[model samples]
Target: MSADPTLQVSVLLPVYNAGRYLPEALESILAQENICFECVAVDDGSTDDTADILNDFARRDARLRVLSRPNTGIVGALNDGLALCRAPYIARMDADDIARPARLARQAAYLDTHADCVGVGSWVDYLDPEGEHIWTWKMSANPAQIEHDLLEGGIGGLVHPAMMLRADAIRAVGGYQAECKDIEDYDLFLRLLEQGHFSVLPEPLLGYRQHPASINATSNRGARTAIANRLMAEARQQRGLPEKVLTPTPATPESSQLEWIDLALLDGNWRSARKTTCRLFRSVPLKTAPWQALGKLIQAALGKLRIRAGRIRQFVSIF
Candidate 1:
C-alpha cells in the first residue's frame, strides 16, 4: 500500500556526480504515463551540482523528492532509499540512465498480476557515449530460464537497473549489504530467485548509458569477480544445484569476440561491428549462428538507419 493513495511504485534513483544527465533521467520518470510513482532520489554525497539539480526538480514536481548524504556509494544509497519507500513496489533507476515512458506501468502491472514473482526486470536499450549506439540486452523472461542461466559468472542473465521488486522480498534479504558492493544487485537477484519466482520482460524498458567514468567502470575487477563467484556458488548450494562451475560453453575467443560485436552494434558503431563480424566469420565460418548474425550486421552497415540498426541488434546473438 502507498502512503499516498495514488502511489504504486517508489523509484530509487541514487546520484553521485551525474549532474550532466540527471535532468533527462528525471524527466523520463516524470513523463511516465498512467503510472503513479514517487521518486526517492538520494544525492549520495555528490560534489557536483547533482544535489541542486535534484532539489530544483523536486520543487517543480511533488512526485520527485531529493535526499542528500555522504558519498557512501550505491550500496548505502540503495539501502537508505529502500527504507524510505512508501509503495508496495520499488523500481531501480540510475542518475545517468533514462527509463522508458511505460516502464513503471508495465512492471507494476506485471508484479500485481504475478504474485509468485518477487521481482521483475525488462531488457534495456544500451546507449553509447554519443547516444547513437542504441542496442537492446536480452535477459531471461521467466524464472526457469534465469535458474538455468544463473550459472554463468557475468551479468547473471539480469539487467539490474530495469528491475522492480516486491517490497517484502527486498526486506526479507535485509536489503543491499555493504560487502556485496560491486555485485550487490546480482547477489540480491539470486537471493530473491531462491525465495520466489522472478522474471524479465522482452521489451527494452530502460536506456542504460555506457560511459568510462561510471562507478562500475572503476571497480576492482578481481575483487568483484571473487565476490560474484562466491555469491553465485552460495546461491547454487542453497538451491541444491551441482557444485561444479559451468564453463560458459564454447570457450573460444570468437565466442568472447562475438560479445564485443553485440556491444559494437549496440553502440551503433557499424564499423566496429562490421570488422568484428568479418573476424568472427574468418575464425568460425562454420558457426551457423555467427553466419546469420554477420549477415545482419552487414545489412545494418549498408543501411545506416538507426531504426534498422536497432532492429538488426535484436538478432545479434542467442546467448
Candidate 2:
C-alpha cells in the first residue's frame, strides 16, 4: 500500500491469543485525539478469538486494518506490520495495554518539533491483570541517560509498547531482528540510538499491563540477559569504547521468591501474596524488593476496599 499522506501515525499492533484485552487496547488506539492515524493490527495465527476480535473492531472502524497469517513469532509479525504502516511515524502498541488519548498526539508533536530525536516514549503506569494501577514507572527524559541505561541493562529503559518510532529510522536499521526475539525492542532501540537520540516524555501516557502470562514473567531470564549483554557489547564496540566484561547479576533466592509474590498479586491470590511478602520481610529485611512488594500489597488492599465501598453505595442508592 502507498503511504497515506494525510495520516500522521500508524499504530503497529501485533497480537497472538490476546482476546481478553483486545477490545480495550483497540479502543485506546481508536480513541486517540489530535492525530490522524491508522491501526495496522497483525493477527499472527492465533488459535483463540483474537482474530475475531480484530475483525469486529475493523468492521466498526475504517482506520483499523487486519492482517492474518500463520504464526511466525513477534519478530515476523512486527516486520510485516511495519511494512504495511503508511505513516511517517509508527507507534508500537501491544494488544493488552491502554494508551491515553493524547499519547500519539503528544509524541507526534514532539517528534515534529525535535528533529534530532528518532523516537520518543513516555513513562507508564504499571497495572495488574485486572487493570488496577500498581505503581508508576518513571523513565529518564535525558537521551544520554536512556542510552546509558540501555547499554548497562539498568532501569529507565524505554518500554517497547510505550514507544513511538520514526518509520524511516526503524526501516533503515532493517527493522526488528529475528535473532533478538525476546529482546528485539532493546536491540532495535540500541541501533536507532546510534543514528539519532531517543527521549521519554515525563508523563505516564500508557497503562502497561503486567500479568503472569506476560513475556517478562515467562521468558528465560538467563538467555534474555545474555542476548542483552551481547547487544550492549556490540553497541559499545560500535562507539569505539573499550570492551569490558558485562557481568550478569545472579538471581538471589529472595528475588525468585519475590517473583512468586508478584505472580500471586497478578493472579489476585491476596492471601498467598501476603504470606510471601511477610516471608520476604523476615528473610531479607534490608532488601528493596520485599518492601516494594509490601507497598503493592497495601495498594491492592486499598483498591479492593474502594471497589467494595462503591458497590455498597450503588446498592444503597437502589433502595
**Candidate 1 local lDDT, 1-319, one digit each (tens):** 2355567999988888988888889999999989889999998999999988998999999989888999998899989888888888899998788898999999999999999988888988776444434456777686877766765555545777888999878999889989999789888887777568778888989988865455455556667777877877887777688775433233244444555567777666776566656665776789864686676686666777777777778768544
Most lDDT-accurate candidate: 2
Residue lDDT tens for model 2, 100-210:
999999999999999999999999987766676655767689998988777676534699999999999999999999999998998899889867999999999999886
Once fitted onto the true fold, the runs of candidate 1 whose alpha carbons sit more than 4 angstroms away are: 245-262, 266-319
lDDT of each: 0.78, 0.87
Q: Which ten residues in a row have the lowest lDDT in candidate 1?
A: 246-255
Q: Please provide TM-scores, in order, for all candidate models, with all chains considered together.
A: 0.78, 0.81
Query: What is the number of residue pairs that collide in model 2?
Result: 0
Q: Can you give the lDDT of residue 187 in candidate 1?
A: 81
